[model samples]
Target: MIFDSLDVSYGDMWGSHQGMTHPAPLSRAVAARRHAAGMEYAVLLSSRERPLALVESWPRGKWRVYLFDDRSWRMQMIDFKPHRTGMLLAHRNTRWQFSTERERSSFKWDVQETTTVLADGLVEMRTEFAGPRGASTQPLHARTSDRSSVGPEPVPVRLFPAPVEDFLCPAPEFGDWQVFAPFLAQQGHEPATTVVLNDVSVDEGSGPLRATEIEQLFSSGACDTPDGPAVVEPVDAGLLRITSGRLAVSDPGWIGEPRTVAVPPGEFLVTLSLLRTTYGVDVAAAKVTFSDIPPREWEMALRPDEDLGLLGEGEFYGVGVDTGTVAFMDATRAVIEDELDEDLFIPLDGRFTVELPGAESEPNLIAFRAGRGDGSYPVWIGRTDDGQVGCVVVDFQLHSSGAEE
Candidate 1:
């Protein structure tokens, strides 16, 4: 769905009109607005109008970014793909330059314009966003040789958002969510059904956890990890090794540009939600707790700088579990990339210690099985009653389906 627009000045960067040429006439500017043109806005002015800023992405060569507002009402994201021909190559990249339409503007990139150079014959050069201004404009030559070539086909980088109506859900009142375990329990269905999402136990914590269960979920051959001689050594000391690592989660099998997170640094307690169904035991979700305080307002686990937004019934951001697996490690190390999806049930890992190359000590990697094989899972940031981060949770939505995988 069309989630974002970088708010670029609409230019005819793509598409051809009848008898028209590149850079379509200004009258067709509306059509051009849907282009991930070779540009990024230094600032966005219409803040009140476009408040939906929630970015999301997948590994299938598609990029979608969203940014949420403070009130946490709506979301916005920009998704586009690169055309094989070099038409929108610049626009095809994942633009991490984020904006909340606020005062500060830090958008940076090479603002390129073609120029004829008699010294090097007809040569094209590029310049910075501001360097090209002033009377003494210094045309900065590219660090690499020019690659201004196109293929036979012109694949338009589809930079557009889906209709807002597409996001409308028959959801309940939006905002901070309560512990849903009680509500889900009320919907009694079958035996061994994946019921537990949040801690439904007698108010104590979720677990002390067992090594056997951890192995089945995270240390199995199905999950690729560091295994040479000490196969289950990490599982033996899983809990101790688990919490000592990073707060960020990751999709170990993710295919494209690695999706990572800069997590809140602190000591975390690792716990699992092993929900049993007719298909056998499954890791429904996983929890990494930092404080005993229950989350007063749960927000999507976005980067610290991302503006928080209230989510509706079916909106979130987390890691994409493509291999039916997800991992949690230190964020500073870029060891994990993640998504914290909703649906409180948990599970999912077997933590192991591995001495990574160039690293001093062995950092823990909590790899766990995702609930429903592979899909985007949301990681929820549980804030303490006092608005502090108490925990981080990734829900697999096992209960949503009928005791199935």
Candidate 2:
């Protein structure tokens, strides 16, 4: 009897019976052995490579067979009728008869069958059965004989626990308004809404105004406005000057020509109003709120202005930052090898989750940038599922930098 049980038993367990069909001759032989009376026997068959079959004959002429076909893609069982001759020819003849006819003839059938008897007296059979256009070929074959030989014991299978739930890493936190404010201002620029400052200049000794100096100037209450107290803060490569009320200026040094600038209260208010409308958040509050979230090392695909010195190496240098692609030389190859697509590349857009060996949770955000222009380099940032957070930078030049010439 063929039984499907959910629980694992002492005997072998075949998971699913779907797409399973009987192997004609072998199936018949097994059925005949089931009815045979008072027969207790054991048979083992082997060839040059390994054991081919292990058969046990029981009382009432019944038999139990464990056959392994090394050539088949998946595991399948064939039931067969016991032949009186007790020879391998009994199994071969079953194949010929089944290959010639079909239980359902409306479907066209094409078969390819072959039988070979090795010099060691082991018989090998191979048969392919094909049906309609979408029908796949079913290959089946087996060998039987009276002589028995001992084969190696079967290896036990190990099962692993299923994953509990899917995890998602938090998105990388971009710098507060220091980075986003400029991006927003650049995007907000338009011919119809352009604001021009007549003249502006600051004497900060030569070179350029350092961020520390700008911050000091703002905190010192050097610049005051009619609306209220005003402050000038440093952000990125620019300065943001805002009044207690509505007057404000972004990217003060962006234009380069303005040594000194005079601003009309009405016009200043209008510009500040526009900026407020565009950002939809109080500039100071937004900056404060974002600052509290903790800054992560994340930059856009086209931007990589951060610096790395002796402590660590730079990002990969192949692909450009604008390509939205990053490649790791040999650093992350093992980590992402199995998850790579046809091109051997994985997308950095967080569309797919990767299994990092020790990761416990997915990163919040992941970003990549090419350290160079060749498209072979990669730099990435993410919080690993294991709750680790950091950046991975790989560059061929860095690798060779320390090499003795």
Model 2 CA RMSD to the hidden true structure, in angstroms: 33.1
Candidate 2 stretches greater than 4 Å from native: 1-51, 56-128, 131-405
Q: After superposition, which runs of candidate 1 have C-alpha atoms over 4 Å from their true positions?
A: 1-237, 240-246, 255-267, 303-313, 334-362, 401-405
Best by TM-score: 1
lDDT of 1: 0.36
- Ten contiguous residues with the weakest lDDT in model 1: 172-181
Candidate 2 global CA lDDT score: 0.24
Q: What digit string (tens of lDDT, one per residue) describes model 1 on residues 1-405?
A: 121122211112223111112222221222222222322111111122332232122233333323333333222223334334321111211222223323113332234232222222222232222222242222234222333533222212223333333222121111111211112111121112232212111211221111122213323233322221111111221331332334557675453433343345543557666554445556656766667665566656664433222111133445777767666666544332343231111233332221222144544455676765788776766677777766666766543421112
lDDT of 2 by residue, 1-405 (tens): 111111111111122221112111122222233224232323332233332333434443333334334432112222223333331112221122222324323324354344333334455566655545454444322113322435422222223332211111111111110111111111221112322211111121222111111112213222333223444331221112221212111111121211111211110100010011222211110010112122244321112332221011122212232333232111111233344442223532332111122233211112122212232322222223433322222221221222111
CA lDDT scores, all candidates in order: 0.36, 0.24
* Clash count in backbone of candidate 2: 48
Report the Cα lDDT for residue 97, model 1. 20
